[model samples]
Target: MKKSLIALAVLAASGASFAQSSVQIDGIMDAGFQSIDYKGNKVNGIGNNGSATSQINFRGTEDLGGGLKANFRVETDWNTVSNKGNTGSASTPVVAGNETVAAASTFGNGEIRAGLAGGFGAIDAGVVNYNTLGTYLTGQPFGTAIGSGFRTFYVNDAQSTSQVRSDNSVKYTSPSFNGFNASLYYAAKQTKAVDTANTVTNSVTTAYGVKQTSFGGLGAYDMQGTTEVGVNYANGPLAASFSSLKQDFKDVGTGTTDQTVNTLGANYAFGDAKLFGLYQTNKTNTSSVNNKAFSISGTYTMGAVVLMAQAGELKNDVNSTKSKLVALGADYNLSKRTAVYFRAESIDDKAGTVQAALTPATIKGADTKFARTAIGIRHAF
Candidate 1:
């Protein structure tokens, strides 16, 4: 009887442990206000404009025994101001309203993961996030308020029709060793194929002009795919990262079949200050030839004040045009989770030339020159 009781106790303990390994919920909530000026017009916009953007993330994991585990996450954006109809809204809606579930596994090495995570390596991917190449080449954080002034939809014929995110994607990550690691990823196309009409001729006519006949074209749904590879390294106070991304669209009518981008960046930190720089190039099969960008930024922290400055240039070879931006900002940290920030930026596009494609948002004033000044508070929980 005692042995049987001991066996039962073990079984209960195992059950309890299994239950403990089930799932957990955690997330962060961020919200803020913002305003901008366009050609002397003060346009005000608010809510989750910066790092304090609103979001809710829920993740769960299961221990599969033998150094293997299964994990999943369902993350979405949450507007603290209004819980309106659903978890998403028209302005700052959730990235993938009903499709934010990511399931993957981790082998014994904790560093290797396979599933629906962000892109491989240093790139982050999801319904709301940009591809690794796009993220790096854009040189902007997930939701940075700055850098939007010069944003463009297509560079060198490469089009970002949809916000960076891929559905039904599989990704893999390698463990970082000595402050270095690599990643590779592939995204599947979830689109359908269609048929079109075409004209063809069998052979040249003997005496009369060659004749052509119309026939139904045999077109299939061209499977689209995206491939991304990146490497990141961080040692001591210095860090660097690079990535390459290729986006392919098949069966689309006469559009560029592929878009390729390359990005490289490095940063160095010195006690209370840090300096960083980035470079990017975009190429496509269309006439837009090549688009290039470069930027440098620095930040210094002293007591309650953190000062920042950044300068960047974007160039489009086809247009023979260039655009430049300079910005300065300051932040006063009230606490670890809260801070007040103010920033101002100046932009210039060569006269009569289209602005560089790299700028995220347009400049606020006439002659492609303007500034943004904001004083806002941010908090995270």
Candidate 2:
């Protein structure tokens, strides 16, 4: 009789523990028609991510004893227009967050993460991303990926390049205290390339970016694996973020050098409107070249409608290069998770010379320019 009672008690405890865990699946379905004019060349067609990036996500959490918890997340990039996947770029094999880099395949793999949280904060291993930092940065006052996205999408070389999703990476986020929180990420390694035997050489060109190899092959670089730090504060209507990122490539020889990027971002809310700004700089430890970029953006809300505008500039120190952009858009909310959006953006390479095929292929080459407009509907579920 005592054995039976003890068995029932154990089963009840197990049931209670299971009850504390939960799992959910959520995603965004976004599609639109876009009309783009690439330096007088025009194309109008169905598009993906009109107002946002379309992706699917699965996440779950389990409550543990003593202020500790276990959590996991997996996500993928999708294109509603072509029903394609996002096969991230050569530089970043798997992208998980707001991106400032390039894309190689039509549909790239996004982020997969698992972690633990407690009084010390949280730690996530894998592609530690929660996505669309670009979406967050661009949306600012009024949230949409298309309108104020010119600053993030159009510029090729900018100081604050978007976050490069790392393959073998881990991140730690501290608990917020006094409206301040910080995050640190250590990107361990890169996904294997098609040509795994390619030695880190000086000036070896890859599908992603040109390698600057020289000096007895003493230097190597890989933009994928790096260390990143971000600090943020929010007290009420005002918020700000500061970040530092460093990229290092493994060495085939000796004296391998790397590069660094630093950024500052801020925003303020005033009644029906909000202001946003960002500035960034990139400096190479081995080279004399440096890059800088900045943007000012805002959004206004009225009833069920939101309006947005943003402008930015990129100055490349390599060859007196300059790129400028402007973007605008509007959105009408049908509900909290459903909306219709429209946006227009333009970019100009003021240097009047296309550099090369490096940035987004849509505006490849030097002295090239383009304008884009998109209208679509978005639903989150």
Candidate 3:
């Protein structure tokens, strides 16, 4: 009889512990039709991620004692049109000169993190999104979607190396204190190389933006990883943020050069309208060139419709190069989790290299200009 009683007690304790944990599944599905005119090469297609990246997410949390919690999140990028993963490039390739210009792939694990949280803050380790891309997501009216000014410019050189998504990373986010918080992120060294026998790997280029050829017969290369810091403030109708990111690149024979970027962003809400602004500067020790970019955007909401407009400029100070953009769009909410969106955008690059958001291609030494139009539906759950 005592054994039966003890078994019953144990089962009850297990049930109670299980009740303290919960898991949820959620995702977004977005698709659209887009027509892009890349100065003479025109293309139209059914597109994915026209308004938002389609993704599925699994998130869970377990409440522990002493005001603590254990949390985890896993996200995967999905392509609604193809029923496969995101291809991370234009479905139709653009031809510029004799080269086929294809956008670099932006597909990743999204984010997979597990960590503990308490009154002090939360710490997680895994593949994570760095805070330096605040303008791409937070400070822009389009939020990295089609027609986003920053996405059109920053996708090329600003974040080509490693400021967006990082692997083998650890991050800490402080608890909000009176509308202010801070974050720190670090990623360990990521290395890739050919065998020592193949000392001359030709013009092998690394993710850290370096090319080398058997420098002193080393036949090895590595990225020194990244360190980033961010601070943000949000209260009432105002939100502002600042971030600094540094990445080191090392080649077998070329030594190392440090690349750094600093960004500042802010947004203010005025009744039914909000105004956003962002400014960023990037530089590398290997080159004497410096790049700067700034954008201003605004949004107005009325009933079930939201209208947005944005303008931005990117400049290379050393070469007197400039790229300009203007975008206008609107979204009509069909329901709480469903909406239809429309966008029209234009970009002009005379002597610069700034690709459009949907069509990531640019002509060199020639007038690279394009106009894009898109209409899509987005559903979330």
| Alpha-carbon RMSD of each model | 11.8, 8.4, 8.1
Instruction: Please write out the lDDT profile of model 2 over residues 254-284, one tens digit for every residue.
Output: 2245667676778999999988987777667
Off by over 4 Å in 1: 1-33, 39-41, 45-47, 79-143, 147-158, 194-224, 287-289, 349-371
- Candidate closer to the true structure by lDDT (higher is better), 1 or 3: 3
lDDT of each: 0.51, 0.62, 0.68
Model 1 scores what on Cα lDDT? 0.51
> TM-score of predicted model 3?
0.80
Which tens-of-lDDT digit does each residue in 112-194 have in candidate 1? 12233222223323332333533443343212445433343122113442224444455566767899777676766423433
Candidate number achieving the greatest lDDT relative to the actual structure:
3
Query: How far out, in Å, is residue 310 in model 2?
Result: 0.5
**278: Cα error in model 1, Å:** 0.8
Model 3: lowest-lDDT 10 consecutive positions:
93-102
Error of 3 at 229 (Å): 0.6
> lDDT tens digits, residues 22-116, model 3?
67778888889988777657778997777787877877777898989998888777778773434555433121110112223233347778899
Off by over 4 Å in 2: 1-15, 84-108, 130-144, 149-163, 189-224, 250-257, 351-367
